[model samples]
Target: MNDNSKVLVALLAGVAAGAALGILFAPERGTETRDKLNDALKNLGDTIKDRAAEEIDNLSSLKEKIVENIKTTLGAAEDAADQAKTSATEPA
Candidate 1:
């Protein structure tokens, strides 16, 4: 997977572990702990979704830039070749 996905996965895992520990040590009722854990998980999911979208957008932009650079370099090479051909065919 992409970097963003990896980071998101790591973050979610950490959050889940932390929540589990919190619930274990919390003095509150079992129902309250469960609710907090659920909220945390839902929020983490939303955050990951948003970040992944942004990362995809960035990757697309980078790809476009790379394609453009390649086209420019090819154009320059073609121009140089044309100039060399013309010079060689001219009277010396």
Candidate 2:
């Protein structure tokens, strides 16, 4: 896990803890409080899922870019080698 991901996880944890504490301490009926807490948790879960999907997509794109770059580099190297060989074989 990168630093950014670790920081994000820590931030999310703090927010969830703070939200839960706030909701528990607020002056409200028990049923309503429970309902609100449930809703908040569900929303947090959805947000995490969405973020996870975005991260997966980003990683996939990075992987594709790395693969493309490697291919390009290898192709260039091969072309350079072929040119060197052809020049060396030519009568001088």
* TM-score on alpha carbons, each prediction: 0.74, 0.88
Task: Judging by lDDT against the true structure, name the best candidate.
Answer: 2
User: Candidate 1, which ten residues in sequence have the lowest lDDT sum?
Assistant: 2-11
lDDT of 1 at 38: 86
Candidate 1, residues 15-76: lDDT per residue as tens digits?
A: 77888798768999989988887887788778878977988899999999999999999999
Alpha carbon lDDT of residue 57, candidate 2? 100
Instruction: Score candidate 2 by lDDT.
Output: 0.93
* Clashing residue pairs for model 1: none
Runs of candidate 1 exceeding 4 Å displacement: 1-11
lDDT for position 37 in model 2: 88
Pairs in clash, predicted candidate 2: none
In model 2, the worst 10-residue window by lDDT is 11-20
* lDDT of candidate model 1 versus the reference: 0.87
Q: In model 2, what lDDT does residue 61 have?
A: 100
